[model samples]
Target chain A: MAQGGGRVQRAAVIGCGTVGASWAALFLVHGLDVTATDPAEGAEERLRAFVEGARAQLAGFGLTGSGRLRFVPRVPEALDGAEFVQENAPETEALKRALLAEIDRLLPPQVLVASSTSALLRSAIVADCARPERVLVAHPFNPPHLVPLVEIVAGDAATAARAAAFYRGLGRRPVILRREMPGHIANRLASALYREAVNLVAEGVASVADIDAALCHGPGLRWAAMGPHMTYHLGGGAGGIAHYLAHLGPSQERRWASLGNPALTPEVQAAIVAGVAEEAAGLSVAELEARRDRALVGILKARETVAPDPAQDGTAEE
Target chain B: MAQGGGRVQRAAVIGCGTVGASWAALFLVHGLDVTATDPAEGAEERLRAFVEGARAQLAGFGLTGSGRLRFVPRVPEALDGAEFVQENAPETEALKRALLAEIDRLLPPQVLVASSTSALLRSAIVADCARPERVLVAHPFNPPHLVPLVEIVAGDAATAARAAAFYRGLGRRPVILRREMPGHIANRLASALYREAVNLVAEGVASVADIDAALCHGPGLRWAAMGPHMTYHLGGGAGGIAHYLAHLGPSQERRWASLGNPALTPEVQAAIVAGVAEEAAGLSVAELEARRDRALVGILKARETVAPDPAQDGTAEE
Candidate 1:
């Protein structure tokens, strides 16, 4: 397969929505020839605009791909000469299944096909593909071009490793799941955190703005530097996680037991909507997105300067 | 109350453990005269060392307070002439209750006493104080001199607002809980996130290191910029959060329902301890901490440059 790659020279993005467009931009910025196709009428314009906008951010990472980008109206045409395929169609199972089947029919078995499905399992989605072994899930976080996490779930270890290497080559931190799970790793963690965040707002424990402030200013800052495990390990002081678990495990259990599971009743949802509006104050969604993206860029730059990822530095065990 | 504050000139730190020392460093760096006391042997020496190490980080934010730090062996001496009190006694309820009562006795009713307890409720701890109304919880995240969050809980809105103003004056983001809850805001969210993180390890979905990488690289970066509510609001596209909830709320609920509540069995604890050891590789806890602090300093600097806290600027509604 394209698994025994030197470097993937050509990539096909088989849907030009935001995810696909971002993938296309990332591929282009990494100097890969990209052929992109989306059925929507204005897909080409939107894709081009996204790439244009993402170029400066990608350039900030010192990535300036010189490869050509071609837009095709059909998936089959885009798959021609493609060594890798990234399918980012709608989230509907039947649609993705049918799309993958068609892509499997058009492409050689050597080409790896990755679906950017955040919620679906690889086993469920790959059922229709004749070469299902080559198809896996490679979920990227939102604004995929910027955020460097790519969670990969594969049918086999080799495929997962190959995907990880490819993404790692592109300056992305690819976490390979030993087993496919809903929401994978990061999203599930995010979902867990968000549930509590929603609960806090639902219970009127704090304003949406204050809760957000608490996160960004508190654990969020630390999480940006390290993960929960590492943070706790550090919190354990000199004796480390062993010491922490020995002493603080009960408190952790108590806190976990007390965590809220609030349903998004209409009233709760309305409160959240209103609270978010108040938090946003005068800033529009676009303005907030822009601000978030800018802040993300600054953080990425800072993290790079302070502590480059050990995985990227070839020190971490796969 | 001393909180009728033009500016708080003197503060008492009622313990010299890590939390107390960090608070002392923060107060001293903000130009507040700090009188600190602790019962532990060599407490003064450790406190001085911590402050000396923290000074460099505080200076990065252009904070170099001219206030004097006095190390007293007794709480009465620490409280003498102190305008505000930050009690960081050990987490034992009985100990904190007695210490707080003593502090309350030593000071006038107007001198606000903020306890730095993470677990004990204000109602429980303040019961011993003659002026229970003036005592409140003002919890800071670890390494408080650096991280900008301070979660406050009080019997009344007036005290909460007063504490918020005081914390804000020190350039800390103080989130006031409308009602006291176990783990308060940030810790609850963190515990929620950590529970999922531990589950992933227990279930063997991914390595602890990879999960950490996924977080720091992805959502952690966005979170450092904005919180979950604002993040989803932006995720809703032009429709904002109302649209997001209307469309994605079901998916959120599904994920939350599927969230795991893993018990920290001995085996599970062993796995996490081992996983953290592997993630840490050869780096000692002190080395990891120093690395984390450096990254934090860099991130804090970057955040300051990109998006100064609106709360500090007096833009957001109290």
Candidate 2:
């Protein structure tokens, strides 16, 4: 709804689970009054703790949105005076449809509503809404506050453009999809890669630890700085993407042909679990999360040095 | 081959291409007396320049090995007193076979020879060698000195173990494959993902820039620290990888079913070229490479802060 900083003062975060809490913290850090609603027990306490945890990370990136956060138990009250709403409810189709429809009916037509659905389609989620044009899928990766991607799939061009601008203002990379697709773009690519990764483990081509190391040390390093297309473009030497398709296309096709589609049988599942155990080497999830977040902060800062924030760069061309 | 440090003092680098030059620099940085041989014109000057350029990156990693670098014009002369030989010749079977055979005849039995072939198989490449056991594939990602991954695919256990130990001593993550397949492990996984990325571009689902952003901001960051298996393990919540498989396996399969197999048509190629031009925004290939290397150095340093180097950890368990 709001183009720049002055117009959008208040934002509502529906469903204060892990994803919702992250959204709430991010909104507050972006200097928006975040009214977060979650019906779960202890949701308020958890949200507070999550926000406090995210404060250090935001500070690491030198972000201080300085907005107020208010906890509410009812959705209607949360959306009373909010200009933007980010819904992170359960993944059930019926639940998301009903919840989105209720939000659409209660919120004003001008206010935009976004659902953080990783797998669900935006069309299906907003099918029952009174004004579906304003409702879209604004899926973020896990740990929404840290990760910069926000996949925006809108029913109308104006909604997508506005949402893109809003996210850009917050220093997030919002990818607008030309059409609605399941799992959006990132998950589909990840699923494709993971399928082969599973197949390799099941086929005894490589160990789980080795497979993971292969990625993290090899292409994953490149992927951190650039995507598959850009990496290939670089791979083409000075000739760029066209040279790659012409010369290495056949080799890629051969590799694709040999790509595995292994069944995730009981045996495969056991192998993966055992492999992860060895890889973890007694490190708890919390320990791993801290390590991951530290690395993320460093990488985000590194990227910023190379490609400064669009808001700061004054080159906000989508 | 010798296990640990003192015994393996001399190393030989065959071929003076980009991969060969990087291998030369890495070996030299690990304190190996490197004798690099390449017959091409101006090979010595090019090799010296490449090594000088990599010096800053190696220094950033706190590496300073006092090893002498000698340039030789003939392969036999380079291998005369070398303990290890890393071959980086062209991918032609006839050239690799003849070159490897010559090295096998010249070097002693204890000397280990590794090929830097990415797409070609070790089995096929070493089919004509006198002693294939000592010859294996030690594929490195592009710019081998920066990226730490080296996919070791050896025919026998001892050869693979020795190669792993050598790479480990050089501060590299060498993953020993259980079985050799096309593109090995990393490239196969990359190819699987890239196929879908190409398909998305062909289908008009998203732009090239957004596709890259989705990955770099999302899974790519996680990938830089941990592999897919570990990321999914965390995604599984407190249940770890086991819980994830039981609940989310079906969803992954569904996503897999929808993965595309698009042809690398000319139109698709043109679109990528145009999109990359826009994404590049007037940055040259050399400029992008420098930015990538700088970011990589920062990420590598950040990772070291949390997970200390395995050499320092003294628990080199692959």
Candidate 3:
């Protein structure tokens, strides 16, 4: 993963909404010229604001690199001479097919197109392309400037490797999806948790505020470092994940039986909003996000040193 | 929310495993007297290491508060003079029931006993206890030091208020589960995601590294800050969750219909493990955890300032 202008030189972000804007910012901050586009009338302004927000966040990370960005009025303009095209168009399947087809026809054959769909499959998403092999899913987290994960699901196995190299060029940790599943991996897990939380609150067993609190405080914390299987590995001492699973497998199975999402009902919906509302009792979304980003900045800065070696520092033990 | 000595000043932890040690360390770091008991002979050494690990984490957060911690030989001894007892015993109902019985016999009526059970229900686990009112589930994350969430499911709703305050006092975000379910909130969601990841790989759709990579790069990034519902909320702009749901609900449901986590067969298990192992490359479990925690520490520190606020940061969009 060479940091300098190695393989990926310039990038194209073919949308300017939450996901697209984030992708563009990451590319620009990593020193790649970004050409972002959207059909919306106010996309330029939104893109600019979005870029500023992302830059604010990247600057917090110390702006280790630099690049330029331009917002064009048209799609072809945005895709101008780009080596890679990241599509953050609407989630509609038809829209993606049409968009990919257009990019495929216009952009050079060597340019790869990445989709930022949360739920759609890469094969399903790229089925219509003449060069579908070059199109894959390069889905990133919302506000990619802060969070560290970028999932690269190959439309085909070959595309997966190419996507990995591209994301690596941007200094992002790209986890590949061997197989495609709805909601990919994390979202499905999150949705499951959320559904149950709603169910609990809906059933009057607890409040929405409480359910979120449980996760944000409990597993959410541990998960910030390791997944449940890996955590259990440590929980099992030398027994490792397999041993922990073997011992706790029955319990895990029993637990899994009861894991389902809560039905979204009127009362339940009200409760959830109110509960989360209370949890966010004093801060606005922007304020919370600001606070979140600020803390994230400090966290990432600290991580630059302490994070790469948690065990030696006793940071990983308990 | 007042940071003062007038708050509760005592805590107790039983079964000093990773979770228990984290609980004890946190309780002590927050200026509470924590008495920890474990039948394991190496408990002291482990506890010291765990405490030190937690202390370093707490120190990073600038929490200068201190609390007393003593290793008691017996469960009752650990519970003695403790206002709150965090039960981190193994995830066994039988073991928990037996321990609760003994704890009920010794602890006064007012003392709260919170079990750190990952997926167990409070009622079933506390069924054998005579004074079940004082016993509830206050499950924390694996390395409780880094994460700030605490799921406080009141066994009978009797301990709800106290559990909330106690956890909040420890600088944790406490979520209440209106009802008991497997994996609480985060794990349930997590399982949903992991299950699908497993299913996909088992079916030969993709590889393990690719699946993990997809998540790490995609939804995992968003989840690290704003979760799915909220992410969708923003996606919908001012429309909020209801608006987003109204429009995308069917599609989301369509995605949900295909989300499956089948029983792990021998073949599936081998494939899943092999996939993850290949993903692991050459890193050991401990090494992986250390890397995870260190990275998490940085992420968390950066996000610390992004505290959830509701007043000025209106969350109606969620």
Candidate 4:
């Protein structure tokens, strides 16, 4: 199968934990042969198990590819014939730097190396690499095989464009950041929202269950349809965002001023823990995860029916 | 036709703008007689047109009621036989206070009055009313006929509970606030998220369209399935929120500290306006709205298939 201009037929997946396993599944489902490596005990077994589970979900999206997967005990073995590399080691500065340096030394200059680190800087992680220009951050939301978002941060626009095309070819929505921030784009947006959510819980304004319901039922539903900027554009009415900014910008600033900066004190943490337990009712984490995945599958199917024409928006372009 | 223990068979909707018209449509579809009034020119024509459009969407949800709608020129006429009142006047504190006082004077103490004001405090709005305890704020998300969330803020718990029961009877999710706050729960969370969204745009981290896509494709999808708290709970793995809080609290604080506090300056506003225009991709606001409603319908239908049993979580209870 052709992907990224038919240049990436084989891929190396380093550190086969959850993120790596998910990436491997995605690559395999796109018809790219995957050679995955991890140093942990029983890593291959766990990686295979995860991929098998993910394959079921991928099949729901009609993503069936004929690629084989091989597990290796070392990075060099996995990188032997790889055209692309995805690194998902645990987020330790020294460890990631060393691992990336090793991978950089072994691979050719043209092979794109992407990190799945959510907390560390790409510059710091790529410092020890021989060709840091080829190293980039291609962070995916958890369970990468299911979620379509892949945030790309690169040293140059050309490499970023190449990575975006590759991910887009594999049926992912890749957002390329012009510059790197602490949590990329989505996580930062999510953290901002969650901070206010936590503040509400701490202030005793509402229970955990009610707050969750308010979001999923209200703005959350709209968000699944469009982003904040576009939502406000509609909120602006016929005049659009310009009108909204002219009329409602002051009120937004007022709300922002009153936004809380709550500390995650012990009491607040306890309150949240108890609230989540109550919200979860009697369901275990596994049960909740299953529920979430089921709902996600349903939503993805629903979105497919009404997805915008990507051609008009340059969403599908290289 | 019973609502609020069969005490609210008839509802009076004052100020028939977009919010009021949506409320009127929701009430009518819930099998309540609706008497609506507005002083704006051609208000009746616009309200009827809006309701006609909403009725088609409500029918998709199987909410076909045998209620009747009446348009009255004066508030007293509308309130004459009203068992409940939903006020959607302009969000000026003085105007809302005066309107509530008039509504209070015309109605008996037992009849409940709910305001749809997104801004302004419940106490401030109900201050001039003779029976202030009976008045509360029941703020609905946009297009109240479609979205399910109705945030209720009252001076007392009994009033909030009563309002919640009424809304739940109408097939809406009602989150009752223990105390009133600016922007309520959903809007506050939205603003918190949007602030970062704006910050990203201002900082030139990514394009407006990509930022939006990142959200809807990533966290937004998860949000539709569950709230932020629940998302993080799942993120915590088997150990849950407690484990997450203990381990990830510092990183969260660091991100929060680094979170942008972007000013909606002239330049920032211009950049956002241009970005939204680009994101819309030549689509008009009305077209975007239709797209949003269509996607929302699809999502709601999909959610129905996997909706949790509300009985277990007390989600359907008063």
Best by DockQ: 4
Error of 3 at B233 (Å): 2.8
Query: For residues A1-318, could you state the per-residue lDDT of candidate 2 as single tens digits?
Result: 352434578999999987999888888888888999999999999999999999879987778878998998899999989988999998889999999999999987888899999989988889899999999999998888988899999998878988887777777788999998899999998899999999999989988888998999999887887888878877887887788889999888878888888888899999999988887878887787777778777777765222222343433323
lDDT per residue for candidate 3 within B213-285, as digits (tens), equals 4444444444455544444544454555556656766665666666666676667666655655555566777
As for candidate 2, its clashing pairs are: A29-A65
Q: Give the DockQ (2 decimals) of all models.
A: 0.69, 0.66, 0.35, 0.70
For residue B264, give model 4's deviation from the true position in Å: 1.1
Q: List the residue pairs that clash in candidate 1.
A: none
For residues B229-314, what per-residue lDDT tens digits would candidate 1 score against the true structure?
Answer: 88888878899999999999999999999999999999999998998888888789888888888888889888732233454554
Evaluated on CA atoms against the true complex, candidate 4 attains a DockQ of 0.70
**Chain A TM-score (model 1):** 0.95
Q: lDDT order of candidates, best first? A: 4, 1, 2, 3
* lDDT accuracy of residue A316 in candidate 4: 30
lDDT of 2 at B17: 88
Across all candidates, the chain A TM-score values are: 0.95, 0.94, 0.89, 0.95
Off by over 4 Å in 4: A1-4, A304-318, B1-4, B304-318
Best by lDDT: 4
- Chain B superposition TM-score per model: 0.95, 0.94, 0.90, 0.95
- lDDT assessment of candidate 3: 0.67
